[model samples]
Target chain A: MCGIVGLLVKTPALKARLGELMVPMLIGMTERGPDSAGLAVFTEPLATDERKISLYSGLTEEGADFNWLGLGHELKAHLGIEARMAVQGNHAVLTIGIAPEPVKRWIKEHHPRLHILSTGRAIDLYKDIGTPTEVAERYDFKHLTGTHLVGHTRMATESAVTPDRAHPFTAGEDFCLVHNGSLSNPYGVRRMLEPRGIKFETDNDTEAACRFLEWRLREGDDLETALQKGFAELDGFYTFLMGTTDKLALIRDPFACKPAVVAENDEYVAIASEFRSLAHLPDIKNAKVFEPAPEEMYVWTA
Target chain B: MDSLKFDLAEIPLRTVNTFLHQEAPGQGVRKVLITNPDGAHNIAVGLDFPVEIEIVGHAGYYAGGMNKQASITVTGSAGTGVAENMMSGRVHVKGFASNGAGASAHGGLLVIEGDAGLRCGISLKGGDIVVGGSVGSFSAFMAQAGRMVICGDAGDALGDSLYEAVLYVKGSIKSLGADARIEPMAEADLATVKALLAAAGPAFDQYAPQDFKRVASARSLYHWNADANQEY
Candidate 1:
């Protein structure tokens, strides 16, 4: 039972303050998923204009010094990523849907540890396994600034513990997902998706939903349409939160068995796995907190 | 015992938790009067003391779960799994109780003034539950070793696949399960109910002894399997 939390704003105001708000909510739910924690922030004012770029890099295991900012500059010099940004962590991110699969192939072929967190400017997300506080400290996330963000604290049950196995899984451009329940029919769905040139990096069931939603979105379905299709096709007890660069969506499985609460005010909208998470916010004292309806998808667009 | 009266409407009940790790020393036998506690769940959930917590209104699930020695009494109805897995002490509900009232209880006593719902003592190992009114079906579904006394009517399959628990129903049973059977009310059983009621306070005198019947697990499922026709 991994705990996930996220916020989507109609306007991007607070940068590091958003991660600060999400970090406590993630830590409060340590009992649910004590493994690891990670968060991704999407900020405004990109350096490029044509295509979006997402990068994932970690310094510890790589024996690399503080040259990540320079690496972003170097990658832009060669492959020409339109908008370049790096989410601070021990893992590398990728920008998919670029002109050349060979560039993505070349990056992974050279550095096997860094996987694609997200591609295109559609979404920027991050997730890993560990305590929320520890992960926040490890990534120096207090300095991070963004308008939209999502996070996960993992309690491994079905899959082994690894960075790649953590959430929020990136399937394609502008498509990122986070989940909170067990998917009963993961194998059945995986078998169907894998044959269609869709690749998988982890065995977690949540990645199935991520991949499915991404495939539909790329096929020209809107976010809500893809999510409704996800609710209908998926079977299990789940209450998940997903985001794009412009919108935030909350989804519950058919039965609504897992715990979830949503609070909306004029300033921002927030979703968490428990009431305690939302109750801690000062402005949200009178916030109307309620569970998502069965097989329901509650989406908010910025 | 010093009485501390709280209307609960004045206090932010969500932040008031009597956790084991957060207890102040030498609190003594404090009597708390929680008035107008409308559906506050998990009130004093894991209290590990001898304080008496009297809630004057209705409560939701697991009001006094994992209780060690404190005595908690609710003036109104209780939701499912009330006093669930209580280790010791007493929980008395003045009104009816919901399903799984004392499910998986190891010790202590639960007295319900009115009827109790299904699976009342589903996995009761020890302790004693005395219901003044009727009980729903599957009252003692998987009871291990406990005492359940229902003064009013009991529903179907009263003690299905029970272990060593003793069930006493004062009224008629709709139908018995595989190994549960009605037995005569002996001197020892009557005294046990009388003493347990005395401890639960003033709500237990409504039912007469003659209206009740005693039922205990046959212990057949403990060592013998009927289908296998073998003894372990």
Candidate 2:
């Protein structure tokens, strides 16, 4: 009982309407996952010296009324860097001209409860504890513009239904993964990754998968090779959909215990756990729709 | 004698299903047209009236389950369990089908013009399936009776731990399950493939009867081997 959705527009013109098209797709899976929903959209890249961090204040004491401007000024006075921000409800994207590690450390030290969703040059993530429609409306997902995005609706079988535990789990930078099945050996994976200086944010099993794959990417293994290692190390019934700055990759477990359907055309590639989420797309009748085979990686470039 | 039409976009699924269950038999609506199926689950399920259902678009899980004396056709793909536990009549899909396409069916015929997903006919009591495209792993697992004709390749463990149900495949098999072996196709097996292919419609007209190989149980696992220490 989880739902995963990913969309990457091949035609640059279609990027403007990307979020608008994805709203219905996310809402359609509300039945499969009604507890919480989230997504990470990959927009145009930032300047070479700049990076952006997606911050969530839902777990904070101030909630939606958190003073984002004060945080920007604090960064300027304390860290000697100006931070430009775009705030929406409890979520905000803070773009800065410094590495995200120290900025993240500052936020962790000062605003301990503020959850960092993601930090990258091209990705802006938003997730919260609500229905898919509520979360989409909360973040105004319909107005988002990007080349691609990965979204998820979770029913919370393996972890508590908290804002931080909701999916599109990110690790390292500019990478995220959403899962639709449970892992049998998440503790084993965590034990393996923890020894290598990787830190975990939540006890959710999907985080382990997200961090494991990203750690591999950081180690210079290409996406396909890392996934091959994943096939050997990860043991579970999973259909994991991963998002990078330039690609959207999907894979099902050997048994395909979880489902994924891919619909592709000249303009875009859309993936969902079921066809219900994709029936509203334009020219869906002519789309080359098919089910990705088990243990096979299908990667689409944006 | 016009066909009955139901646009799922405007009318709720419960309304359409209610009509088929309560009012359709008495009204003599021989044909039912469902428009914009949009991967909606349980469309035209549990029918008893021998009515002809034409789904104009993709249907979700269990599109035509537990059917009796009905003919259902999906113009697009079908989700998991397209025709599970069907009692009689025919259910056909013009496009690909998700996992467990015709699982545990009792009688009647199920046809897929495209690929069928994993465990397509698991735990089948009886029924017949004809897949024009490939079938995923573990198809026809533990099937007790009836027949299956796959015009394309089969994934790993084609018919593991089978029981009486026979399988005919035209293409390569990734692997066969325990006790399920490719036996010499007898004259009866060829005739069965011929009849099933014809029943599956024109899309299967190209597959000759002799082109298929028969897979059935070796009956090795039928009884417990007390002397063989946990090895099959």
Candidate 3:
């Protein structure tokens, strides 16, 4: 088993406090997984094209439009500067770099199924295997500044011990995901996505789900609709943590074999594999902490 | 002498782990009440002070490893390697202990209230160990010193290659090792066994001083004779 943690805050200052705040929680969970650790922080009101993009839903595999023409190079030419882009949950995150309002407006106009979850600065990323302390020291996470953060500690069962196999995984410019537990039906999902020219680096089932969600969101499906529809297709135990720049989402499998704890307050929202990790944080007392109900999708706003 | 109560579901395991610094400074005798009926692992590890630990349910592996001066009492069946590598202090299992109980023990007393799995007193050096129930195979495979008294039947190969340790089994023996042989339970031996039993706690009341048999090594493995009938 591995440990996963995500926190969403309303203020940018909380983003700056994230690294230091998450370090102790991560340290407390070292025994669950002694392998690699990774974190991704997101800022809202991103400057890239939020409308002309489709989130990469990992549900539908084949016949999805991944046509690069007039998508990548054309957008750069239309816009003055380079756009910050990431792929997550079948949606392409296009930060216009300079102006986020126009890009957010453009995304809302073109893709009705997709909406801007967050409007500030959004960061989507993935990292490799190690203890939480090792990762924090190596990455200097104690000094990083952001508004939203997602982290994962991996225990390799299906995938090989490589950096590529670690989470949080990125699909395009806008989407990222982290997962706990094994998926029994990854091969079936892989068969659907491989034909669409989407290649997977690791044998882990979480990546397969990521690819499927990416494909669906690109086709104009809302995050909740796509996730609700995709939930039935997935088999076995899984508790997923996903996010865009503006919002954080959590999903638990039907069986609830895996564990996910949530602690929420007016200032911040935190999700972790164990209550001890969340309780270890400073100034986190008197918060309402509880385990998430099984097979439910919970989304939080920054 | 402060007492702490740990309830089952409300208990956080990390809280217990963070506080277990028996070798650290300023730690003293404490009374812990385990209100949880469920089993947990690493209940008391690396303890050096004389604290009283009372567990109400079954315990998992290495119940008391590297123990010093504390006394641990378990009221249920113990998992594997109970009291393993015990340096000092005492560990009393009110019920059975799984395999390799008291393996490589250095000092202190290990009293088992019920049966013991294989290799009960393997590699025992010092300390007094008394088992109220039957012992599995290879009870004292390489005992160097100390004393082991089993009030119940002992399994096969009781003392394979023992040194100077004294073993007393009150019940039937399947086999004896290289130099191990049965000896008459003398008055001094009975007195020692009775004292050990009395100290073993409430579960050891039915033990009788007369119904026991004593087994000890004849000091043969220490010196090997080249021309003797022994096979090297």
TM-score of 2: 0.99
Stretches off by above 4 angstroms in model 3 are: A49-121, B2-232
Judge the docking of candidate 2 as incorrect, acceptable, medium or high.
high
* lDDT tens digits by residue: candidate 1, B60-159: 6687888888888997767668889999998989877766888888999998887786678988989788888888778888889889888788877889
Residue by residue across B41-122, what tens digits does model 2's lDDT show? 9999999987999999899999999989999999999999999999999999999999998899999999999999999988
**C-alpha lDDT score of every prediction, in listed order:** 0.72, 0.94, 0.71
Would you estimate the TM-scores of all the predictions? 0.62, 0.99, 0.49
lDDT ranking from best to worst?
2, 1, 3
Error of 3 at B50 (Å): 17
Instruction: Give the worst 10-residue stretch by lDDT in candidate 2 chain A.
Output: A8-17
User: For each prediction, how big is the interface RMSD?
Assistant: 8.4, 0.7, 13.4
Which portions of model 1 miss their true places by more than 4 Å? A9-16, A45-48, A58-103, B1-43, B46-63, B66-232
Q: Chain B TM-score in candidate 1, rounded to 2 decimals?
A: 0.89
The residue pairs found clashing in candidate 2 are none
For candidate 3, chain B by itself scores a TM value of 0.90
Sorted by TM-score (best first), the order is 2, 1, 3
- Candidate 3, residue B24: Cα displacement in angstroms equals 18
